[model samples]
Target chain A: MKVPILKQGNILIATIQSALTDQDLISLKDNLSHQVIQHRSHGVVIDITELDVMDSFSTRTLRNIASILKLRGADTVIVGMQPDVAFAMVQLGLTLPNVKTARDLEEGLTLLK
Target chain B: MEKDTESEPTSSYAYNLMKEMKLDEEEILHRKAWLEFEEPDVNRLLELNDMAQGYATEVIESLYDHFLKFDDTKKFFEDPQVLNRVKNLQKKYFLRLTNGNYDDQYIQERIKIGSVHASIGLDVKWYLGAYGFYLRAVGKRIFKAFKSNPEKALESYFSLEKLVYMDIGLAIDTYIYQREATIKIQQEAIRELSTPVLQLREELLILPIIGAIDSQRARQLTEQLLHAIRDKRAKVVVIDITGVPTVDSRVANHLVQTVDASRLMGATLIITGLSAEVAQTLVTIGVDLAKINTVGDLQGGIEEAERILGYHVTKSLEDDSK
Candidate 1:
């Protein structure tokens, strides 16, 4: 499914609710970048609280989306990552070094501010 | 009756051993294997019980006399009353060794004898030396009594030799088993002591890790850190590892997991005090410790924590300095 990107004033919120395929991630990346440029949003919070799995490709896509959004002058914070997911990600040697993280959506918003 | 789970404080040999603890399967099996190998004639040995009883006092008295002669051995017998009580028990043990029940109860009693010696910190050399005295004393007595019948004396001597070997086996086995059990308990104690979370200040904490950080210890570190942060309401934690000598990939992954988990708890976790060697090890493994703040030592980490605390306090009155 195409990830929903919501706008609240000058900020954009994208909550990934389902498992993402290769094409879904590409579309989601394009969708987030397109919405950030269109609305010229200064802050972005990508909430993946509902996401249960993230392979290397999805992790890379998420990192790339954040970097591209950064060039567009929108600060991005990924929030609500599960502890087990973080544990698994570290074991797989995927620290997502460049990506910003927060405990939840509320914290992510505060960090962005 | 329920067997004795706790040790008895009694010095009396009149202590009812039947009411005591049952032998475990391994002890029973071990004794059975020795009995099979020795093929000791319990009946033949029992027949010599009367002959053994005649000199039981003489055998034990000489054994204690030998113990009192050596400086190391004499120290163990300093209490005259305790010595007398132990001497009486030794006399009875000499008689019962040939009293003929090579049953489970006999095996348990033999094991108990070994445990008592070990518990008293009696040197194994002294123990085996005492057994040696008993063997020679009994053999000398048997031969003296049947000097005219060389064939009969030789038969009895061979049977006594087998019994002494079985006794040695039981005693040495218990000594080895007790030593092994001691090491296991010490290891468990070390594991608990090693994962210490030292609180440096009201807001800052330090876990000065030493030795190898195995997965078990690393897991313990994560849980303890999470609890300490929440309970102490710590703003920052410094995981100091100057004492830790090496870090493999497995250890690196566990450390990363701990860092991630601590951060999730909303504590600004800083891995501080890495030596040059440790820094090289982490880089060699390609551990992506990116974006996570790290300092060279505990002092630098505390300074960083103070800086972070100051920045937060200035930004908001509701922050940590409360």
Candidate 2:
């Protein structure tokens, strides 16, 4: 699934609507990275409220995306992690270390500010 | 009948008690055989059933009269309607005693009766006492009816005694089984009630930990807190462990993991209520507490959370004589 990135002034929003395969995530990371630099967006919010079953690979990808965006001078705030999905990840001992997270898009935007 | 045999056993507690007691047909028959109740005994009970049918109502009434005279059993039959209903059931039970086909169906029915008795809060002492009264009442009739033949009466009475004992055994099993199920359900409810996540403010949550933190309860608490963090959109969490009795290495590890997990979801977890003893235990155990944010007490933890959330509390000086 191609994640559509919406731009609002200097910030970018990417809402994930369904489960994405590894290739789709990699493409999303590449596309997001490219867009961050092209738009010179100061902040990016990746909304995962609709995504269920976030395995280790996705957690690593999001962490990688955050660090990569940091290098490009754009902050990343992962938003809307479902309770069950977060529980499973923590149980699996997987964590998005050194990454900023928010409850929802509104909160994410506020945090970016 | 075939459908009932297939579907009912799987769903009914009585059938479960049967399995738990290992009272399958072979086992039941083995018990009868062990009691020396053979084919001749079955025939003897059939003959006694014909004689007992005439006295079933009389025997049941007298047995109930005995029950009503006792304080413990009398309380169960306070209402006239209940007494009548039970009397009818007792009569049927009395007739079935000698009706002779002691099959799986019979055992299942006995277990159902046993479970009903258990759920109604009828003490086993009362039940056993009632059984004793019933046997004595029926024995009096048997002795009166067999004035001409004592040996035949003895054999018939022995057969009846064996069948009643079997019924008693099955009923006791169901009582124990039902008690165990009730205890298990209560334990689960207690465990669920033990962990509560409270939302103190917008983007702030508090969890007061009490008692022991076994691995199972720790896991449950972690799951509940994570869900609360998401639902409440909490950015700060204050975990107060004042009621916790001990801070063993295992418990310290669980606390550390919980703090880390909450952080992963973008919520800062502040651990508070670490008594001097617990702090000493953690330091003595050499647990890496560097990642954990600790406050001396719950109030301090809440203050710390408020500080992180950009809130300041100011004390007003206008209190005096107003």
Best by DockQ: 2
Residue-level lDDT tens digits of model 1 in A1-113: 88888998888999999888899989988988888989989989988878767788988898899899999889888877665555556657676666777656776788777
lDDT of prediction 1: 0.75
lDDT of 1 at A26: 94
Candidate 2: list runs displaced more than 4 Å.
B1-48, B54-88, B100-112, B125-170, B177-181, B319-322
lDDT (10s digit) by residue, model 2, range B1-322: 0101212233367677778778888898887877777888778888888888898888777877888898877887888877887788777788888888878878888887877777677878888877888788878788889879988777778888887887887778778988998899999999988988898888899999999888889888988998888878899999999999898998888887887777666788999999999999999999999989999999999999999999988997797887
**Tens digit of per-residue lDDT, candidate 1, span B54-103:** 99888888888988999987887788876887787777778887787766
lDDT of 1 at A37: 82
lDDT of 2: 0.84
